[model samples]
Target: MYSDYHVHTNYSDDSTYLMEDVIKDAIKMKMDEICFTDHVDYGIKKDWDEGPIEYLYGQPQVNVDYPKYFKEIESLRKKYPKITIRQGMEFGVQVHTIPRYQKLYEQYDFDFIILSIHQVNDQEFWTQDYQKEKSQQEYIEGYYQEMLNVVKKYKNYSVLGHLDLMTRYDEIGNYPFEKVKSIITEILKTVIQDGKGIEINTSSHRYGLKDSTPSRDILKLYKELGGKIITIGSDSHKPEHLGAYIDEAKELLKEIGFDSFCTFEKMKPIFHQL
Candidate 1:
């Protein structure tokens, strides 16, 4: 079945695509399943109720309004019964933020959750705050090290979102993959051993990147390590971005020796043929 497992709506601070509008677009795209993985970066943003609304990059920054978000999801599920809609969130978890995530995990019954490292020590990558004052090796290694540390402590997620995400914000250029290969291997092994997976985020195409978000090398290494749980997503935040490049992502996975991709329900993986 065709599916886009990572999506964003207005519930996310960085997006303004309305929830119902996104669902309608997914249905028009003939998507069989769609999961709303909105952004919730604990270290960089605040919850809707925690305090006054703040602004980031010209957008009002606020985490998902849980009470209203779930209410709307239920309403939409009934309003549009054709597509299989799932509730999910993208938690931007840092090593120090594990406790907050664990507590949030116990409070919700999400169908899926994407573990992401949007920042480290409250410093964001897009702004280059985390990468400044460090050599390429230092920043890259630090990013992977944080991932390793977080996965070692957090188990409430279904898959790691955009495994090599820091590269997207690196203004210099793609660093040598071999330099961070061992650490990435360790991260993947930990994720696989913990019964977790990684997502092939299609946003790389939108960004005009030379490879997939995690890069082909990482995908190959994951296969070599016998790590099989995989999902594909547009990581869309706009109407034009919705369900973009999904077919190409599937083909790339097939070329990499992966025969199936996954969708999630109640935090469990359900595989589908490529």
Candidate 2:
């Protein structure tokens, strides 16, 4: 049975695809379980001095209608009993947002939550803004250090998304891999120690990165370190992107000595053999 746990719907501000579009594509792909992990980006609310409550404003909401989204998925699950449609969230874990872990965890009944380091102190590394100042190697190193902080701050997510996401932009600048290996390994060790799994995201391939995030070399290092908790994701934002290049990712994992991937049910890890 093929299960894809990482998928973004209209809920993510950057993605505009409809949720059903993704589900239909999953059916075409013959996936046994398709998790709808819409992003819920929480930002600090601007409040005036001496306010009664901490006014939580600037919370970005795209297709983030959770109630409607879940209702639709629940119906789809019943109709297509063959497919398990689990609800999940992809949280952009920042320093301030990290403290709200308890509230987020308690508020939602998510089957899986992918804690990703997308922003550092309000600076989004994904955008071209940060790239102007940091070189490719420096960018990657910054990401790794932010990951170390994000992973250590909270024990909230089921897996870490795209351990080497910076490579996408790195390709443009001819990233210095020789300089990143040590810091990458250091972050992976902390993830292993903190009981979090790394995701072999296929989205990198589709993103024109020509390879998976963290690369096969990094995956091998994780395995060699006695780290068995590895999960695979397509990171697809569109319906057509569902299960995209998953077989290639699976093969890459096997080549790196991983026999299976860890799945989550109610936020708990479960291993499925490759």
Candidate 3:
């Protein structure tokens, strides 16, 4: 059985699909479990336009509606027992959003949380529209440093959403990891130290990154560093994308020496042997 813990619903301003739409797709895919991780960007700078890429009509309070969202998920969970459904969120980690994230952590009982780095300072560095113009080395470096801070500050999150999400823009062309591996390793070491999971985000394939977020080499490195907690996700924002290529993700993890994948319930992990 497999579980996709990173997914989004209408609650994410960018998504127009409903929670039930996601559930129905999960059923079609014969997925064992799925979590709804809608977008919850805590602090986005107002001068976002000055950044590399242009964002569509600024996302607002994808975070605030969680209380109501939780109620909806709870209702869906009861109705969709054939396929396990859980509550989770994908949080955009800005350097200054930790306090708000911590406050949310204290109040909610979620199945999982995936912390992601979508912006570098105010830049929409994760998308190609902007990253294509920046130096690959510089963009990759910023991703590591920013992610390190996130792992250090948020102790409760289950996984780091997409370790090399900067590739979403393809601007990270032919960027050699040799010069940057140390920084990546350092950030991963902190994640290991903090006892969190790093996800194998399959969405990278959709974005044209040869290796899903964090590349296979980095996955090996994460494993070598004794960073044991790992999970797999499609990072699907739509129903059709919900369980896309999960079997491929399973194969990739095994090739990387992950004998099993993880699932979450009440904020705790339950490993399933592959």
Off by over 4 Å in 2: 44-63
> Root-mean-square deviation of each candidate, in angstroms?
0.8, 4.5, 4.0
Total backbone collisions, model 2: 1
lDDT string for model 1 (9-66, tens) is 9998888899999999989989999999988888778889999998867878678998
Q: Any idea what lDDT model 3 has?
A: 0.77
> Which of 1 and 2 is the better model by TM-score?
1
Candidate with better lDDT, 2 vs 3: 3
Once fitted onto the true fold, the runs of candidate 1 whose alpha carbons sit more than 4 angstroms away are none
Please give the ranking of all candidate structures by TM-score, highest first, separated by commas.
1, 3, 2
Please give the CA lDDT of all the candidate structures. Answer: 0.92, 0.73, 0.77
TM per prediction = 0.98, 0.86, 0.89
Q: Per lDDT, what order, best first?
A: 1, 3, 2
What number of backbone clashes does candidate 3 have, counting pairs of residues 3 or more apart or in separate chains?
Answer: 1
| Per-structure clash totals for the candidates | 0, 1, 1
For model 3, name the residue pairs that clash: 128-169
Per-residue CA lDDT of model 2 for 34-147, tens digit only, reads: 777777555532212223333113433332566676787778777778677888877777767776565757866878888777666656555555566766656667777777
